[model samples]
Target: MSSISSRDRRHLTNGVKEHLRELSVQLALLNHRVSAGAGLKQVDLDCLDLITRHGPIGPSALARRAGLHPATMTGILDRLQKGGWIVRERDPEAADRRAVTLRAVKERMGEIYRLFGGMNAAMDELCEEYTPEELEVIAGFLRRTTDAGQEVTADLV
Candidate 1:
């Protein structure tokens, strides 16, 4: 394989960073619109997304992942529960009898998914432009970027 020159590598890296920043802002705006459409606060929707992605998760774990305080998480959880977007149930497998886990309410997910349908469709169309190998590389970069963000968030917390 041919190696990129240092100058070219730096240029590519700067371009990627600039694109990522722009992507972040655009994603935030999209999420804000989605949250408004769903009648949920941005943080609450974000927490629900975390639970949907990582459930059945404990409240404490979800709080950590969302970078929210436990008390704040409790309020978010309560709202989600009241809205029928999520449920808290005793973790039968947990050794601690009272330990509860958060789960996204499957039946209620349709509303959220519908709100995101446009974005999902756009993303699918975007993915159609890339070959599988290129998509894999892009996915790998995104996964690594997400991990790095989590690590940095943990440090900040």
Candidate 2:
């Protein structure tokens, strides 16, 4: 049998890297299609969580809360607006022009939640095998990953 050189090994490794990169992109696109069909993209879900926690907020504030750049937030808002999952209204308290605020279209929220077959129900299914403490630990790890570069890595596709 012939032996392989170091260069050959490097080419093999590069091939694996390229394969994995393509797989990751395909999976990400599949996830987006699934989530959007379910009435939410990942960003839309994040924005909903922010609105649920903070009540009404401006797009700039939502950008900060979502840990996304303003341009990224604009795209998310566009999808959300198209879905009727969110809306923008002028802030009554602000006399100036730049006071428009973003908020959940509350009436559509329940339908959105229902479209996902009730998020809690789905999460419960996923967590069923884990103890509460174990689930908490997993959640903590996921949060940390997200707080770092996981969010950006996810959007790379």
Candidate 3:
């Protein structure tokens, strides 16, 4: 095995742990604000995101995409439907069958998107302190981390 000093390993490992913890705290706060009183949780948001991006899909597919179990996705659809945030329509190709799809009620969701957009803008401004090359390096690192996570999780199935 290649040898690395304990100090060097600790430096790399501690930075990764610190970054993960900070990301978790930040995401929790963001979710709290976006999901407040919506009778929805983070999984619900993930379902919505999948539907929004991919258009109408069967509950099974939606569940798979959102990393949810099939039965739980059914419950999520019911809640979203009851809230009028999503609608289920008969699948044109399949008579007497419907697909669960989601669309944002623009009036209700626009404000949230705007708030999110504002936060992004602020973050971008903060990032301006770094040169474009520095930001590129950071982005590359993040992308590699994300790709690795996806690969490892995909292998578990």
Candidate 4:
């Protein structure tokens, strides 16, 4: 590889910074489009994703994992149920009779998956050019960035 001068390095870093900001905005807009295209709210899609990833989980645990208030989660679950996007069942081992667990309607996920799957497939192909070591660094950077955002969000309105 050719050596990059300090001046060139600064320019590349600035480009990456600007591109990352643009990516963030683009992702927000994409989520809005996907949500609308799927006839769902962004938060509802987020809840469904969480359930799809880690569901058959109790609502209280799901609410905590999602950073949503219990009351708000209740409404989200109600919508998901009415949309036929989720399944709710009694938590067999819970002492509380009202305890329930939820899961996404596995067969109903196709539209949401179809809407957002292209970018992930493209990103996976792009990652093929990187060596394992470089990818690890990229992954670490992303995790730290997510952590930083969570820290800031903890302080937000």
Candidate 5:
């Protein structure tokens, strides 16, 4: 929107697009490695990640987030529960007390952490190159990209 040349803007946009694709592929590879390490399918691993991020939520809410059928969520939950990666709990004192919520098992998180710790450590090292002001700009860029992705997904739904 500034007075930047159109060719320069196009080059910058293409760079961002390629970086996003590379990030997606890297994440998929990481997912595969971690899931296999934990004896889980990739989708189940992704479902567990969603629960870790958005829990403690109900199964229906989880399915909605994962774009899966309610029945499909049940099986995924069952597997995770059997593996002791998550639990379904209910609050007795709350209204609608019979409703269940999903949460990750804290103890089992070590496996996930171990699988991801190397990448996280590398990212931490990379952050050291940037000043706080630079980081703020980087964070804003990441947040905008995430918001843009969510907006697109919402539009499709």
Candidate 6:
């Protein structure tokens, strides 16, 4: 195999950074459109997604994960509850009666899923072009990128 020169490596690194930045912006725009179509704010929709993926989760924990203030999370949760998108349940097993967990209204998730169906399908089609090893590498890269983003966000927050 031919070794990459330092200059070529730097070029490839810059290209990857640019593409990742573009991908982030495009994803945000897509989420904004999907949120609009679903009649929900983008942040609210994002919180709902978090709830769906990590349900039986406490409000405080969810707030941390979403990088939202507790007050902001309260409003979002209220709206979601009012819209029938989520349910807040008191932890019966806990000593504190006020400890509440958030859960997504699974039946009401169809609309959100339908909104994202096109993008999901496209992603699946794209994945079809890659072999298992290539897919694994892609997945690993994405995972590391996400972790890095979260780390930076945590520092800022």
Q: For each candidate in turn, give its C-alpha RMSD to the true structure in angstroms.
A: 1.5, 8.2, 3.9, 3.1, 1.8, 1.1
Q: Write the per-residue lDDT of candidate 3 for residues 48-92, one digit (tens) a residue.
A: 667777767777778777777888888988877777667776676
Judge candidate 2 at residue 47 and give its lDDT: 84
Ranking by lDDT: 1, 6, 5, 4, 2, 3
Ten residues in sequence with the least summed lDDT for candidate 2? 111-120
- Please give, for residues 1-157, the per-residue lDDT of candidate 4 as tens digits: 6799999999998997898899999998999999999888899988988899998889999887789999999999999999999999998899998989998988899888888898789899999999999999999988987898888988884
Cα lDDT, all candidates: 0.94, 0.76, 0.74, 0.90, 0.92, 0.94
* Candidate 4 residue runs with Cα over 4 Å from true position: 1-17
RMSD of 4: 3.1
**Per-residue lDDT of candidate 1, residues 82-118 (tens digit):** 9999999999999999999999999989999999999
Using TM-score as the yardstick, the better of models 2 and 6 is 6
Q: Is candidate 1 or candidate 5 better by lDDT?
A: 1
True-structure RMSD for candidate 5: 1.8
TM-score of each: 0.92, 0.54, 0.73, 0.82, 0.91, 0.96
Q: What's model 6's lDDT at 92? A: 96
> Rank order by TM-score, top first?
6, 1, 5, 4, 3, 2
Weakest 10 consecutive residues, lDDT, candidate 4?
148-157
* Superposed model 3: Cα runs more than 4 Å off: 1-6, 37-39, 91-100, 114-118, 155-157
Please report, as a residue range, the 10-residue window in candidate 3 with the lowest summed lDDT. Answer: 95-104
Better of 1 and 3 by lDDT: 1
- Please give, for residues 122-149, the per-residue lDDT of candidate 5 as tens digits: 9999999999999999999999998898
List where candidate 6 sits over 4 angstroms from the true fold: none
Q: What lDDT tens digits, residue by residue, belong to model 2 across residues 3-74? A: 899899899879966976796797577556646766676678768768767868888898876669999988
| Candidate 4, residue 79: lDDT | 92
